[model samples]
Target: MQIEIKSLLKSCGVTSIMVTHDQEEALSMADRIVVLNKGRIEQIDTPDALYDAPASLFVNGFIGHANFLKGRTSPQPGTIALDAGCALALAGTAPPPAHRDVMVSIRPENLALVSDAQPRSIAVTIRVVMPLGAFSVIDCVTASGEAIKVSQSRAAWSGRPGDAAWLMIQDISKVHVFEATTASPSIARA
Candidate 1:
């Protein structure tokens, strides 16, 4: 139904306004999207733009499933100390001034299971595994009880509940850092 409607809209060569609460539908059907939160425009961008580089925390959360982890700016520039007992090196991004509370978001697809030999790997205990056809969603928890989700190919991952594993963020650039709302709502590059 959706494919046919989209085809008709395309064939007609006319602009059509589609309003929906479904994020996936909006992303698939429109060239540009405006995200509204509490009746205010939060962001306006292409789906890829909104997903890859969200303008705000609200838009980041609204567009997809993001693991919001607590972190603190390390003394070293471009480094973040996660409350989850690991540090993230965001070499490609701008860091906030040292010693500030921050919130970090990493999409599940950007995380991969890695060996303990990996220097930047994070330790987590697997909690649940949901196989969704070609992909598998694994739920894990850090030492601080921070829940993180990882999506991997079903055939590639063979872990079970209660297993301790290491996770490596596939792309540090995809990691987004935001100011802790306790003081103010702001954006950070990492």
Candidate 2:
């Protein structure tokens, strides 16, 4: 379907502006991604940047699966103490709002299964496991009931449901922190 649209655009010599609710469709069709929320433009950037470095929490959750972690800000500098026993170091130097509720967005693919040799291993219990063609997704919950989804290799887990797994976030640097949005002003991102 995407190839057909691209071919049509090329043949007609027309620049098309396609609006789609599906994020994959938008990523495949548009050269520049425009993310709109509630009839307002939230972000306009390249596809890679839009996905990797989302402007806000709505953009991050819309582009990919985001695990919202509750955390607090550190007094010293660019550091956050996250729930589920993790301390996140922020890339930006500015201090976050102190004593306020914060959420961190981390992509599923960035979380990797780790062995004992790895440094950053966090324990989680598998609630459910669903196998796609290329990758297997493990639905897990931390000890504190914060749900986490990790996309791992098909061969990573051999057991059925109710198994324990430890994952070491391979790309911690990719995690982003954003101010939480409320229901007063609903925002949609695509």
> Scored by CA lDDT, what does every candidate get?
0.85, 0.73
Runs in model 1 with CA error above 4 Å?
A: 115-117, 182-190
Score every model by TM-score.
0.91, 0.84
Q: What is the lDDT of residue 18 in candidate 2?
A: 84
Which whole-number lDDT from 0 to 100 does residue 146 have in model 1? 84
Clashing pairs in 2: none
73-170, model 1: which lDDT tens digit per residue? 99999999999878898967786789998889899999987535378788899999999999999999988888899999998779898999988899
Query: lDDT tens digits, residues 1-190, model 2?
Result: 7899888898999997887888888887888988887778989998889998888777887886776666777674667776666666666435367665577777788886543424445667778879997788888887767788888788865545777767676676687877555631123433
C-alpha RMSD between model 2 and the true structure: 3.0
Stretches off by above 4 angstroms in model 2 are 91-98, 115-120, 183-190
Best candidate, lDDT: 1
